[model samples]
Target: MYGVSTYALHSLPLPAALEQIAELTDYVEVMDDGCHYIESAEPLLSYDLRYSIHAPSRSVNIASTLEPIREASVRVIEDCFSIAAEVDADVVVHPGYFAWAADRERAKRQFARSLAHLSAAAEERSVRYAVENMAWEFFFLQTPDELPLPDGAGFALDVGHAHIMGCLPAFLQVPIDHIHIHDNDGTADTHSAIGSGTIDFAAVMATVGQNGITPVIEVEGIDAVRSSISAIRPYL
Candidate 1:
């Protein structure tokens, strides 16, 4: 029912994107630091955009074999949480990634440790955050049977990523609080419109309806994102 993810138009510069947010939507997802730095400024900027933070995706990792990277990941999330505090936003973050490593147990441990650290940081500031189910990543929380979620944790069901992860229903079984709806091809992750790709919209929407989860569909550019929102408007 809400508009598209602002991350769809992330290629734009921060100020330009802020201007677009000023013109286009009310609930803007401040998906990266560029947006955060602008939105988190003091003296109250002119923008009326209500925000939610999505943690940045970079070379940093919470599930890293190196302690420094893990520490860096924690620091990055702390920065995100700080920005959330500044904007009074709910921060959303992917737990961690384990690429090229087939070690599930090690990944699980790293994710747990990272969540534990960030969870404390989030609570100290009383800023809310959600754990997202990422595609083809090393996080155990993607699949239901893979890892256990912490008590205070929430879920973000990325539909496109779920298709790639092969765990939509399993993820649904968990107590989902929010959803990241998108479409993509079977082999590659393309954030397309709902019906434009291979994802089953009817079944997924049905499952979401049955479970009472509302979705925020993600897409590419502003026009395509608007079209996807229009397409799903009737159902919502």
Candidate 2:
């Protein structure tokens, strides 16, 4: 089955977004940011749809070299894990980035440490999570060579980000536990409708089918979400 992310209705309250998305698909990935930031599963309990959370990414960097910042980032995700546990949902997270070129090695070390902590916490809560590949430079795990995730972490493949980075084909080769599907020109992460951009959705849909994964339509607006669902329906 296919799913939709609340990101398309980010301008609305979480409940409102969920209400609209539920009408379109039985599965939804909550983009926990802005108006949709989830502090508890109480709001989610009302929905009948299956859930996967895109944990809060803004202002959260698990790879920060500063001890407090890195620790705080882990804590933020730990709280998300608590909510996921209550809902029996999986989560999607971004790999942290370094501020300067000189700090890349330090940031990687910090990220590894944070990942270890998160793995243990997730196990405790019985919630699974996948680390997503990023679109820009200075971010960790942007390529397949960065594989063999530390502490047995899972992977969430974002096709738009991978396309922007010019590595979608390589990322598609990796074992993906979760996926975010959207369209974009080869140069930017536009999160456009499925057929509105250059991405070869036929190949993407084929891989998703092979993996038996539900692809989350992570586009820009409610209209784009509808368009994406229509575009991918043929593949589904």
The model with the greatest TM-score is: 2
What is candidate 2's lDDT per residue for 1-236, written digit by digit as tens? Answer: 79999999999999999899989998999999899999899999997879999999998999999989999999999999999999999999888999999999999999999999999999999999999999787999888889869897899999998888888898888789999999988888889999999999899999998888989999999999999989999998
Candidate achieving the largest lDDT:
2
The 10 consecutive residues of candidate 2 with the worst lDDT sum are 135-144
Q: Which regions of candidate 2 fall more than 4 Å away from where they truly are? A: none
What are the per-residue Cα lDDT tens digits for candidate 1 across 1-236?
A: 46446677678866566576556567667567443344344422456766676777554577776678888988888887887887787777777766656665676677788888888998899888788777664555556665457747667777787788777666666666667777777667788777777877777777677768556656777777677776676666
Q: How many clashing pairs per prediction, in order?
A: 0, 0
Cα error, residue 152 of model 1, in Å, equals: 2.0
- Give TM per candidate: 0.86, 0.98
Colliding residue pairs in candidate 1:
none
Q: Give the TM-score of candidate 2.
A: 0.98
